[model samples]
Target: MMIRFSKMQGAGNDFVVIDAIGQAIDVEQVDWRQVADRHFGVGADQVLVVQRPQDPGNDFRYRIFNADGAEVEQCGNGARCFVRFVHEQGLSAKRKIAVETLAGLIEPELLDDGMVMVNMGRPDFHTRDLGFVDWQQARARGQADIDDGIERIQLASPAPEYLPSLELDLMSMGNPHAVLFLDAPPNDDLVEHLGPFICTHPIFPKQVNVGFAYLASPNQLQLRVFERGAGETLACGTGACAAAVLALARNKAREGLQVQARGGNLWVEWAGGQSPVMMTGPAHTVFEGLIVLPTR
Candidate 1:
């Protein structure tokens, strides 16, 4: 079977977006790992499958698969690319549309400025929401603290001599993330070293994305994220939202903060409380192509 796909990117987080709505796609038949492999296939951080919404209230259904072929609940960067893909493919004409994801319904709109803005729903700070299970144990061991409904936990450092431990804020933006504030600028070495440890930490039963963030200013944040299944990419949209919301909740940064990722910049806005986080960023169509898939 042959499948048509678009190579798209949002803030440098690239994806191979397949329009399952336009063609017959037995998702199970495609080797997602091969599709996302850098050498063997159309390289991408993730594969996005666009299907007709199961719920009539939604315009479409967005499915995300990591490089490892694991289907995930949400992806912010991919969400932007998703909107652009549907329009470019003549699938939708509306500037704004409601899409159903495993996490929930998300609304993404194309702006006059050529950027995509997404309503990522309210952030969830409850440990259970992120599939984080070690909170109670950490609290009993005096390694965790809860204030204002946000939980902060201490994680032992990979190198105890240089840094005994690090504090991280755990939250879910439809996906799990651990945000670690850094005093200095984020370097590749630091992110590569500590990111994996936190991503696969035992505390998180389903694993988590790790974000190393530096507050450049009250409204400017520099970040690097090591994704759960894709390792570190050029950017992470949900990571930006997670980090920004955590900063806002802690009063470390104000709303409308600009998050600078390695790939590009994303703007995040939130009114706090139960308000949804709004993320604005660029999404581009790199190219389109057809690939053959094997029949079962």
Candidate 2:
């Protein structure tokens, strides 16, 4: 069957948007590897499927799947693209609309210039759930020490980061992440080089998003994350949340700070030291087209 989709971007983080409303398409049927095939399929950093709201008092419901087809919660870049897609396609008339995601319900406000700002709920944390074994195992496998009250998982990797030298903050916002603070902005080559290394590290049972942060001030930060399935994306919502939390812990930045990602800038805020984290950013529509589903 031929399915119509919209190709959109938020700060360079691209996605394939689909409307499953009144359609019998089983979104889960598209496997991770298949959806990420650039030659045989619609290529994108992630895939977003629009559907009827699962909750009352919401404008719509949408789900995010990484290029590898792993369903995740809350994509900052994708969220921005989502609202723009809906507006462009005449799905909603309101500029401010409430939508539900795997992470939770969020309100996205569309700007006049076509940028989107979303109220990404908060950051989540769990040392164990982020898929790390105990401290000793991570130290041995990842070649790092787990001090400073930060819980971590050190999944094995073919070539891992210098764990002992780097400080990583672990968290989840419906997905898992590991954030590292760097002295300077890593070159694009360095980012591409180490991102996958940390993502596949032995300590993270579920390959984790690896974020490298450059702290500019107590109120400003620049970050780039190698998303688990998507590789080094322009921006990452969960990674931003984790970076904000980690920055606060190290006193590098305060809550309600500005974070610059590869895609663009995001405003991240934290209330309680260990409470939910907030992420805000933009979304844009690039074009719309049709894709024929490949038979399995």
Candidate 3:
């Protein structure tokens, strides 16, 4: 079967967006791995499936599939692209729309500059809130550490990296992320090397969105991320949020700042809002095409 799909992006994080609202397609049959496979399928950081909203009050139901074919809770960049896709397709005429994700309802606003700003809702900081714990400490003591630090609170678990522990900042901007700041942002090669290590590190329970960041300004940042389910991508929306929150906590950045992702630059500034932060960026529609998936 030829599944109609659209390619879209926000910053540089690209996606294979499927609008499954009007028709019924067996999602179970889709070999999503091949779709996200860079060598064989439609290469992308994440695959987004857009469905009609389950709640009449919402605009759409947003489903996310990582390159590994695992369905995740949320994706900020993907959500922006998803909204743009629907709007350009005439799915909704409303500028402000709500999308239901595994993480919950996320409000997206269509801006005049052709960018979409998302009210990623309130951020979740506790580690256990999203099912994660300290893995390195567990390995250290052969007993494991139960509490791993995320954004604000630490959840109990086993394992913390290093001698006694490693500080992991966990934040949920609709999606779960584990962030660790370095003296300076690691180089690309280092990011490629240690990124997978920390990503799969025994300390992270559900794995994590690994980030390497260096503060550029109180309102500016430079970063590279290895996303969970997806590998290194040009950008990550939730990843940006995680970094922004961490920057704020460390006083590295003020309430607002710009986070430079591998994909492009995202304007994020948060002082205090219904949502603590606001991510503003452009969502673009690339050329549409039919991609044949490999059976093997």
Candidate 4:
């Protein structure tokens, strides 16, 4: 079978988007790991399968699979690319459309400047949802609040190369993330060295995306994220949203913040607590191609 696909990128977080809605493809039967392979298949941070919405009011159903073939709850960058993909393909005429995801309905809008704005939904700060033990103490003494917060936690490190009991600000932006605020500028070495430990830490039972964030200014921040299954990509949309919420909660950043990732910059705005985080970035189509799949 020849599967048609579109290669898209939002802030350098790329995806191989397949139009299952139009093609009538049974996406569940497809081997995503083989399709996401960089050397042997279409390379991407994740694979997006666009299908008709289950709900009558929604425009589409967005399904996400990481490079490792695990289906995740949500993806901000992919959401942007999703809207762009549908619009370019004439799937929907509306500039602003709602798409259903594992986390819930996410609305993404296509702006006049060719940028995509997504309402990433409200972030969850409660420790229970974030897989943390104590909500009150963890929030109060989060690493953002104390200098030696990393030493406060008694959790053992998952690896010997990493430090034990690293303090992190946990949150759920459709997906779980552990934000580690750093005093100095972040580097690739740090993300590569400490990211794996933090990502697989026993604290996060479902695992977590580890974000290394640095407050550059009141409204500008630098971030690098090690995604759950994709490793460290050039950009991570949900990571930006999670980082923005954490930065604002810790008073490190203001409402409108620019999150500079390794690939590009994304604008994240939050109106404090219980409000959806707005993320604005660009999505581009790299190319389109067809892949031949074996009949299993």
CA RMSD of each candidate after superposition = 1.5, 3.3, 4.2, 3.9
Off by over 4 Å in 3: 134-166, 272-274, 291-296
Which of the numbered candidates is closest to the native, going by highest TM-score?
1
For 1-296, candidate 2 gives per-residue lDDT tens digits of 77788888776788888888845577766563565577767788898888989776788998988877678766777777788878878888988888898868877778776556677665555556434434556565665444555664433333345433444667766677777677877677657767887777655667778888888889988988898878888877667767877778656688788888766888877775545555567776677777765534
Candidate 4 yields a Cα-based lDDT of: 0.84
**Global Cα lDDT for candidate 1:** 0.90
Candidate 1 lDDT, 73-98, residue by residue in tens: 99999999999999888999999999
Worst 10 residues of 2 by lDDT: 155-164
- By lDDT, the best candidate is 1
- When sorted by TM-score, best at the front, the candidate numbers are 1, 4, 3, 2
Error of 2 at 89 (Å): 1.9
Candidate 3: what lDDT?
Answer: 0.76
State each model's CA lDDT, in order: 0.90, 0.73, 0.76, 0.84
